[model samples]
Target: MTSTTAPKPRLSIWMRIGAVLLGLFAALLLLLALFPWDALREPLNRYVSERTGRKFEITRRLDVDLGWRSAAVKLDGVEFANPSWAREPYLVRAERAAFDIRLWPLLSGRVVIPHLALTSPTLGLQMEEDGRRTWALGKNTSDEGTVPVIGLMEVDQGTLDFLAEHLGVDLHAGFSYDSSRGEMPLDFRIKGRYQRQPLMAQGRTGNVLQLNAAGQPPFPLEIDAAAGHTRLKAKGTVAELASLDGIDARFDLKGQNLGDLYGLLGIALPQTSPYALSGELRKRARLWEAAGLKGKLGLSDIGGDMKFDQSQKIPSLSGTLRSRVMDMDDLGPLIGLPPTERSAKAIEGVAPPPSITEVKRARRDSGRKVLPDATLDFERLRAMNADVKYTAERIRNVRELPLDKGSVQIKLKDGVLTLDPLNLGVASGTLAGAIRIDGAQNPAEIRAALEVRGMQLSRLIPKIETMRTSFGKLDGRINLSGHGNSVAGWLGNASGDVAALTGRGQFSNLLLEFMGLDGGEIIKFLLRGDRNVVLRCAAMAFDVDKGTMNSRSVVLDTEDTVFNVSGQASLSKETLDFVVRPQPKDKSILSLRTPLIIGGTFAAPQAGLEAGSLATRGAAALALGALNPLLALAATVETGPGVDADCQEVLAQAKRPASREAAAGAAKAKKQ
Candidate 1:
């Protein structure tokens, strides 16, 4: 048994055949090396062309190394021309594509590519403005049989550059995939930047995005992005690709500064406060049929829920917004308006005049609960209301009257909107009124009413510069009504009334000065008690008509003087026509009855005395007193006219009884 085995050991048919096969392969290689490479160039070109559907060119030099288990193929250039969709061709340009082929898989009639490396690949994707995309796969391929299924061992480093002119979008990306399983695991990074600045935002997002998706159809993805100083993170699973149904899990966003966000978006929000924002979005569906999406947004102290449907043409959306108290002045700069003007001169005229009156009428309209679309809608907005206080050291009006320490409150709508009242505290009282605005109309309307009470004459006289000629401290009430489309129009249609009471006041100085009596003591008088000087008049009341107030008697009480005045005044043009009669108890200081006339606008007023009336009244009074002293005395004592001697005699007679009683008492005592 031992005999033979060792000696005959090897010589099996399979071993002999394997040796022969090896020898034949070596011999074939040697022959192939000796042959010219051009002889096989045509065949190689045909093979590459058929496989890739691209024209292929082979170089003259080909290096084959049997031991290295590889072949080096140098190509001049390669280009892939895609089939045309609408008479326009799509192209892909590559500088070179070099790869390694594993020899072991050759025997199995399979091409197992160990590694594929592309140097520089330029892909051009186009879309017409009419919405025709060039990269769309052909319908014939989808209608035909199943596409070939090939497993690629690995794609090492592949760089692709895509450009689309119509979209103004450029994409540069690098990726790799493992194709062992039917599912190819892919990891890619791409960046996109818009070519034009959007109306809502600006700036470029360089190195803005990074993404990784692994494990194929139902792969998990993670995205991180940076835009200016803002950063965002997202992660989710692509669970069902057929319908793009999946869930997105998110954590709070951080490090997003409001100022920085505005800068990135090229927007300038009103100069308010800086705030932080954080939120999450969940249950996202990107499919067409079941197009549903929901999310929540949180900004600083504000929070809300949002929902949308992509299936709708306009992408229906609904949400609620909430915020904390914010200042109204901060909104001024945002809307390109000045917050406050130190001087009226600094204040710019209203643009086309604010429609304050129109807004008021609209609010008063009976048709709808809402103030109509003419008014700005603050939808579902809520906040803590705050009061705006305005303090000015001194305020000067158009009449050149200066007011001091004036303050007023501006009621704010939830601390977001404000209405300017244009009122000030003066004369130990407050001026109050409301102004309504309607901005929807081309030329708006405005209506306002102001009530003034207990105003001091000393303070008010200067306000009406025309009244400077009148003297004494006066107290009165004024009511003003304004209606018009513009400031000038409103002033032109203004109507008001003033009622005044004067106490121990005198008008002598004003009269003398106005009459041009140089150093001549014409008349000196005093008022003992309260006197009514009523100004009950309407300016532009009836069809731009006017009314007036007239007084029957005005008496001035003093040691020996009595003055009676009567007048009718017109308010619109500020004209006064009056009669002044002066008389003395015992003697006449001015032998005259004067007719005084005041006429002019509020800006400038003039007064004149009639000389003829004064001379006639003086002569008559003197004649009457001389004719009947007793009658004149009676008139002087009771009716304010008399001769000085008669008046004095009557006064002495009235004092004689006390002297007579004293004399009788002394005589009786002496007799006793």
Candidate 2:
């Protein structure tokens, strides 16, 4: 050709090399299409077994094929043994699995999978107490090996089981995925027991294969679950296929009771009424938060934000809560007391339905007894620590205790709960106090200190007209400590002190005169319908010991009369016994025979004259002339510059003057 074809134009080194490579690639493709890769199954099995540190086997067959665009490897009846510590014999098994390798990567001397498809894959995942898991692939990766990129991973009719014995979790679930309809749809359903409660879950997610890749955010996910009567629903987006790191969603939870959550999570909780909640939930790594929460607590509307940190062995929850005009009745469920709503209905003669739950029945049973014996759930108290605060604009809709506005701070740590400053606006006064409860002990220990100040008595009792009895501001305090399993037990074993004081006020003249044994004035006022009496001061103090409150100094001073009272009230027995003797500034012939007596139980207190007091008047009338002035033996009055005095001082002053009387008879007890 041209004698020498012009020396063939002298082929360049690069063109010659490219031609050789093209011919080789053509030959390789032909080889790949016709090669007998199935014959290497035994060697491949051995290689897989060695690399996985597990007994990997291909029971059926293996095949390699060249498609128009890529090369694919197919494995049949593939199985791998589980870790030695796992109870299951196999960690995973697949009826068939196929992987398509990219041609360009292969041509470049690297392996990359365009897609991995699994058919009927079964997986066994287990977690042990030592934090070891059966799901970990055994010893397959080398430190110097390059990371393989898998563009797509898919499974059809996949089944997975996870067991955590120590945590009482045993779940079996099925997964399915399909992308032919344009949008990838992955769905799963599970059934199991968690924390010993029957659990169930069903959910769907978007584009799981897309989410599997690195640097990719998770797809949208939705889940609905139930544990016992509790129901939960969430719709969200999450990052990372393993750790649920970046998460944002809206969550709604509902149940017949919030306390029932304790059965699913090892947390202590008080019995609660039916509840429903909805909120915005977000999470980052080990931190989780729920904000803009709105819910119904019993019959009240509530809002709050809560955050949890899982950085420690024991998680902690912190939050702020708010409510609008919460009802004290709603709190009844928190303390195992009779439900306030039900109690109110009962008072109106509406019979409630029979209880259906064990908790409800337990509350009903406790209501029958005079004292609370319900054992607290301390297992929950040890589960976690918490700090929370709550505030309310008002509290109403309860007759036994009506409150205005209130705030309470709650802290719990190491099985101890403290309410260091429970402040409330109630009874037109301020009530502030601190309470501590230690559940670490077999019998919980409780201590409390409370004070009431600037309380207008008329605000507490509607029958007391403010116009009639300017009832003045009253101040009081109570301090108590006890160990018990219930509120009743605590009160029954309490030891403390209680005191009350009032500076000046007014009372019904007829009532005070009658109580003071001023017969002439009482009878005269009864005829005229009554008048006002000026009260200078009133005070009462008691020392509680072994569930009994003994009066230290009980005094009521009025312009016309001074009264001294002494008594012991038994909280355990709910009995009362008190004696009142009126000592007027002036002597009265008829008043010597009367001593107001209070006796009986709190449910039915009785007031009457002391025994033989009326008969003493009959006899005293004979000696009235002789003992008229000498009746100073029956009189004692104490008044001091210091507006406030201890009970002992007031009692001492009364007895000091009486000591000079030499124990006179009833004829000297009367006053005018």
Candidate 3:
């Protein structure tokens, strides 16, 4: 500095840098003002085409309006070709498009659109089962950038077509937006086929420009849609509309059967009657919930909270369900029965749906059947897993059994289903059991064990007035296993043991006389009216092999009479062949006793005296009468040689090893 003397005042480095930057800015502005963006259109298209490995072109004029911090771009015609594997030729086609983007964000690797408009634009999207997606523009090099921000957007005559082979979805959607409508700025309609079923939907939503806004506000929405016979109406708000990340809504759902939803939502459900449900629906990234669920399924009222988790490799469903009033008839579909027409018709007072009608027709063609035949959808069972708890406070419409409250814990995993602790109140007692079904096998396998305790005979036979004053109780047990996909098939091939017994109690004398065919007591009871009698013990035991049930021991003993039963019932043929022999403890007048025969199909049972036994007895009576009129009565007199049953032994035999194994399996599964 001393040597330079007064040569000059040194220029500061800051001033020099400022002057250089000012000159560069001026040069940039001049270049932008004079440049022809149309001339660069082909180059830009080529660059984009090379990057994406797709054809890209600008068919008409391309222009840009330069600004201090933003730029407005306009294109008359644009088109982007689709992948070679796509069904459509083009991925995008637009007659005209324009947008204003902030310039500074680009340097930071962000896209910020201040305004955007599209006219006569069409987009095509395709997805495959192997994780291929058309809309994903080039390779996903990184997951670093935030989603683009858009301030305002407008669309006119825009349409899109989407196909997803993995989901069996094909849809054509039309969308429009109007900023003039502040509350609802977007409108959309979709018509397609999902899971091979016709689908149609229309909805209104909040401004699409705010989908990625900084201070996120609730996105309002309303939708009305139908898929096959399933219908849904929803109204709600979402935290993020772009990804549907968060949602809170209310919805009403009506469907012909709950099982039908498997196709629409990929959720496995047991077949049910026509149903109408309403509830609050909520969703997170990978979870959905239906809370405060209340609805009517046929004649039953059901309410609960359900959660669906899609975070797992296979989706899962969990819930606690309750029914204040459950109509037993409405649950026919659980064991694979066709939808009950009575319940279906009662829901809407209308004819049953086509699906139900078809099922009914098939059932008719199959002829009369006592057990359910509808096959379970094994694939559906494998598609997802579930854990559910259900409780019924009251039950009605049970014809044969007096069922009261009931509860069960249902679990499914890897195509295996279990209903553990399936407890049901019957005749003021409980029928508790466990059942397992393995759908992984081709023909399927089933194991079941059940026990009955403290079932009051008075409540069981309420129709018999004389039993009301009696103090008899019944207990029973059943253990079975089989390979089949249907209730009928399972029972037809089942191997099992069944036992039932009753200890000392009082019973109806008139009923006992009828069962034993004691003419003397029958006439006496008719003359003096019915009365209670002491019941010593009753026991029944059966062994099932190859679908045939053979009576091991069947006996009933009372103060004045004893009855024994022996025969085999063929479950495969649905036939019964049994013989009943009765003996009296005391002699009586006009006691023409003979073996009673029961022989016929289950659908049409027949009971009558054995012809040969009756003939022999008649001949003996005739011979005795010829010898002496008083001696004739001796022909029908009983020797009172019948033995009583040991109640302790009968009950102990009911606890088979199979039952113990089933119980252990259920406990293990519960712990798991």
Candidate 4:
């Protein structure tokens, strides 16, 4: 003790200086804990601005609490400047924001915020066409230290706005948050538009902090939305806030028309009747998929698989879908038709539901809505490229048009869409065709080519007694081009050629007698219920100009007569006007009818003898337009004004190029 008393030769000067510095640091920390933080507001804001490369300011008040274990820094009326290119005045603004920092970390010049709270904050976000997002914040730099950890976060009555001009997206939403539970819970509501369609959603999320936590998998979410009459519900887990890099979900959808989903899913689809569906959804990296998809589309049952790849500059979709018997009317909404037919009960409180025919008449008379927004949805179309194929085992329950099965191949690249080889099975025949659509064009360019072969006349025209269960082969082709938003609009601006011909077949004696020059046969047909008459041939050809189809030639040859017809059908106005001239195969003194005229709309057709006919003084028959097969005969009929054809000659003439049998052969050859 006595030797140590030397006092270690008094403390070294350097050691004393170090001790003094340590005391000063402790005193500095104490001063920091007690000092008036209001005096340092300006310097603090400047420091933050310098570090974040954004302007920061506190407009109203600031409060600081320092209790080591429970320290906080609160500021009121704070705002951060937006990026130079942003449209908003501020990137973020808050009425009151606070941070709870760990004092121990601060001593080492490190920031460790255990909690952060924002009250009435507003945030702005944007995404450019080049894929740059405003929320990217700032460029990162390498540094060595323990990064700050935000344990809990809360937001009260906050709002966020986002825009993606190229994607036709402009959305705004309100949000709130609470972390009283183990996992931070969040609730949000959105109302605006996406891809130029109205959008709305409500949802809740949990474990949002996991988005930034180390070794965390994903957050849980639940959301529901209504797009027009379509309703969708989803619940799942997700990761990566900026990009859906990891996700898993279960979803269900219900709607009166499936076409409404075109807007919701940003896909091209024909309209369908009421439906319900459920499926599992997943995302990994840049791929999103919907698997085990099962649903009802219109009146048909459906199931399939779908995938979307978002890794590329442009998203692409690939999928395969199939269905059992589906009704063609299910596609009505695709053409801008309403989900349900409007009724007098809905408008004027009429008690009774309108009859199907009445509803149809009303719709036909009023015309369709015809593409509510005629402009092309270019963004939706160009947002992704697709390769999808759909097949239906049967297409049924439509009048006159019985399609047994069909398949369509859909391919899209950039803004162009192509449907190649759209094939459908008819009675014992087939209908094959293709359609091309170019959305890059201002008005959208459309071209279609369709061919029909080997259709049984009786099956094709079951309701027409004139066919009298006729057994024959039917064939035809249509090549057309137009520019517009819908079929109606396209036809209004169309140009095309249409032709059809029928092979040797039998007709109902009632039809032949009704149009014959022999009065005795007409009387006999009236007495007899029904009988078959030999049909030598039938043909028609037309050219479409501005929605009107002008006849080139029309002819029908039967055992007892040759009928030449000329007509024009207007698609825009839906009217048919035609003339029929009959030539008797055998001279008869009882002839009483000749040269009939047909005129009317598709809903109502009227036929009567023309003024110049020998029997013009008498009333004419009320049936005629049912003889639509005559439209293709325009190119083949060689009969002079008053010449009649022998059944043998007509049959021999049916062997020509435009004949039904020849046409069928050509179609078959093309397929082979």
Pairs in steric clash, model 4: 539-632, 539-633, 540-631, 540-632, 540-633, 541-631, 541-632, 553-634
Candidate number achieving the greatest TM-score relative to the actual structure: 3
- The TM-scores of all predictions, comma-separated, are 0.30, 0.72, 0.86, 0.69
Distance from true location, Cα of 625 in model 1, Å: 34
Higher TM-score: candidate 1 or 3?
3
Mind giving the per-residue lDDT tens digits that candidate 2 earns over 1-672? 355434445568779999999999999988977888888999988986786677888889989887766788899888978877777677778999888887876565455676777788888888877666665544522222333556566776788888999888888889887766234387889899877678999988763454235566566778899886778899988775555667898999877666777777544455766667899999877888989999876666689998887888988888998998686766766676545443223321123323323344556443234444556678777778889898998787746454788899988899888886789887789889877778898688777778888887777665667337777787876776767777767767676666777777887776666666666565566687777877777777776675677776689877767787898888777778999877665444335436789998765678988878656664555465466845532432122112323444664433321311211211121110
Q: What is the lDDT of residue 343 in candidate 1?
A: 15
lDDT of 3 at 105: 91
Predicted structure 2: clash tally: 6
What RMSD does each model have against the real structure? Answer: 22.9, 9.8, 4.6, 9.5
Worst 10 residues of 4 by lDDT: 343-352
True-vs-predicted CA distance for residue 356, candidate 3, Å:
8.6
The number of clashing residue pairs in model 3 is 0
Clashes of 4: 8
Residue ranges of candidate 3 with Cα displaced over 4 Å: 1-7, 46-55, 65-72, 83-89, 99-117, 130-133, 136-154, 176-182, 207-215, 239-243, 349-367, 466-471, 619-672
Instruction: Choose 1 or 2, whichever is better by TM-score.
Output: 2
Query: What lDDT score belongs to each candidate, Candidate 1 first?
Result: 0.38, 0.70, 0.79, 0.69
Candidate order by decreasing TM-score: 3, 2, 4, 1
